[model samples]
Target chain A: MRHTIPPRSGAAFTLERGQRLTVIDPEGEQVADLLAFSRSDIDEVISSGRSLDYASRIFLTTGDALYSNRSNVMLRIVEDTVGRHDFLLTPCSADTFRILYDDAEPHRGCFGNLAHALAPYGIGPDRIPVAFNVFMNVAVDGDTGALAVRPPLSRAGDRIVFEAETDLIIGLTACSAPQSNNFAFKPIEYEISS
Target chain B: MRHTIPPRSGAAFTLERGQRLTVIDPEGEQVADLLAFSRSDIDEVISSGRSLDYASRIFLTTGDALYSNRSNVMLRIVEDTVGRHDFLLTPCSADTFRILYDDAEPHRGCFGNLAHALAPYGIGPDRIPVAFNVFMNVAVDGDTGALAVRPPLSRAGDRIVFEAETDLIIGLTACSAPQSNNFAFKPIEYEISS
Candidate 1:
């Protein structure tokens, strides 16, 4: 079924093994932060380190399997319209606004939204790990190791599909951080199918 | 005071604000994983993304300050002998051995050791975040964004010193992963001074 997560908000749901989830950027240049946890054990949450270590690449796309903390497969990307995703960044939070943007009134970013959404599933903020930032553009300087956030390349209707490898609880957000969304927030659409 | 963390083991201690922590590679080519939590609030742990975001560089060394999740200063690097360290990767765990090394008898790596050492302080495994990996050589390919674990360059007596910016709970480990230590395990020494 199709679901829309309003701009700067998040949602959490369950997906059985073999199910598919498609996250769509309905508006151009928006980013989504995705996270997965094993349903049988929340402690076995998705791990960016394990996935990147095994994949040997930071940019994960079609055919890449996101691994759990216990080395188990949680989700495998089967389709990706925008291959440039960021695995290095933690979800932007209230601190992000306070520190990076120097905003006088900081909105709780994706991290806080996810924390609230996942709390019903008994997942706390501390349980959250680095997210698979869908369609987010980040540039890393090869020499100095400095990082810069760039505007996403995803256009309207761009989507990424993931096939669940195990029973999972997924937390997803329409990123609230201004830089990640190119300074504008938009809704994110997702569909789940068996 | 000086303390030794045996090879493949870990320790936890407290440091008052303004005190200095000097982590020493007593034996050549060893790596140490370091973590800090605010003594006043365990929820506000050290954050790799915040530190890297503010610093704009990943190879943290002398003159760098590690930031907490709340964007507060946690530890400031007052001195560093070996310039290279890893902030991108998570602490190596049992899953790392199983998935990366394919070991029949996988040893719980630094993650497990830190979890054990910090459990007494009410810090669970889930609370652990990406550690500041001292003397760990990680090469990130500028073009492909691929990462490789390389041998540390720290020789005997090499040390990195951090001045506590707040009262903190510190977890330190002599990394168990062979690749990080140049295929040899060795004890790590640390001293604290006001």
Candidate 2:
């Protein structure tokens, strides 16, 4: 699938109810990670465990509820653009990048996955960690239990929107699928409302 | 803030040249912990302390290169949404939840976070383990060395993207920031692509 990135970022948004968030993946060719938190609270929702689970992309949906340690409602997807989401899935570092691309140089361009998200509070990798990956197409091999990564199901100007009851803090990786072998470039766009 | 959610059970894809990934946060949002590995080489990635610093998110993102026990590249963020992607953070769990949350509920819901995302892999908390909440906004009180919850700076639709040069596997969580009533409910939106 061929994808054309916009001139601006992948998405643009505004915080208000009944608003919309959009992504133009012209060919289901872009994947993103979505996370949320309370507006008043000054922290993230998932510790490390749940964040990794979210990457699997199993329980993300309209009715699916993501609860924090405090048991507060994180977010509800009011609308969806392109295809469904995959809460489980993440990128790799230089080592794995070399493993895949053989000739690539080794470097830790950015090592913080999900666990790194909560380090600010001294909550090291033992607590808050990995996160969900949306819009990337991958399937588990029934027999081998292997996850297959290929193209995506989104297209140009495709968008997704959610209604955040509380303030949400999101972390997105717009273009590092091949950690060391980036080459993936696109500007995602979005709209958000309270 | 606001966010956009990918479709249900859906994903996006992007193609690249060589290995050049791009990652940018919405604005000033800080992304903390991060984990990466190979989709087909899960064991190798897990056992190796390089790509995924099990004990902490600190060394994970440092300029140091990560290698699996067998010496494979798990991940290397070509770009970073937040500057502190290499910091060491911890994963949130049920035990921690019980110790943190203000109210007393069965299971405490800390494990629930991981349970929800790990259900698909059939890897329960016992099998897979806890996770790290990557990119969560937080801070520490200088005077008391106490963990503080800062309003997550991640705006709506803020994203961090990386190239999947390797089949990466990771875990995540939303931990308890001291600033809140013990159990901080910082919601988040997450996604990824290949």
Best by DockQ: 1
Please, what are the lDDT tens digits per residue for candidate 2 over residues A1-194?
Answer: 22333421222122333333333444346666544444445344533334323322333545444544344545555556644554333333344455545646654322234234434434333322234445655443322223345566667666665555555554444534542112454554454432
The digit string of per-residue lDDT tens for model 2 on B3-94 reads: 32211111112223233333323332333233333455334433222334222233223343444444544444454444333221334444
lDDT of model 2 at residue A161? Answer: 58
Standalone chain B TM-score for every prediction: 0.99, 0.55
Q: List chain A TM-scores, every candidate, in order.
A: 0.98, 0.63
The C-alpha TM-scores of every prediction are: 0.93, 0.42
Query: Fraction of true inter-chain Cα contacts (below 8 Å) kept per model?
Result: 0.49, 0.05
Residue runs of model 1 more than 4 Å from their true location after superposition? none
Q: What is the lDDT of residue B21 in candidate 1?
A: 97
Q: Residues B1-194, candidate 1: write the lDDT tens digits.
A: 78999999999999999999999999889999999999998988988777887786778888889998777899999999999998877788887888788888888899999999999999998777778999998888766787888999999999999999999999999999999999999999999999
- Residue A187 local lDDT, model 1: 93
User: What is the DockQ (computed on Cα atoms) for candidate 1?
Assistant: 0.54
Residue runs of model 2 more than 4 Å from their true location after superposition: A1-21, A24-27, A37-43, A47-59, A69-71, A106-128, A179-184, B1-194
lDDT scores in order: 0.90, 0.40
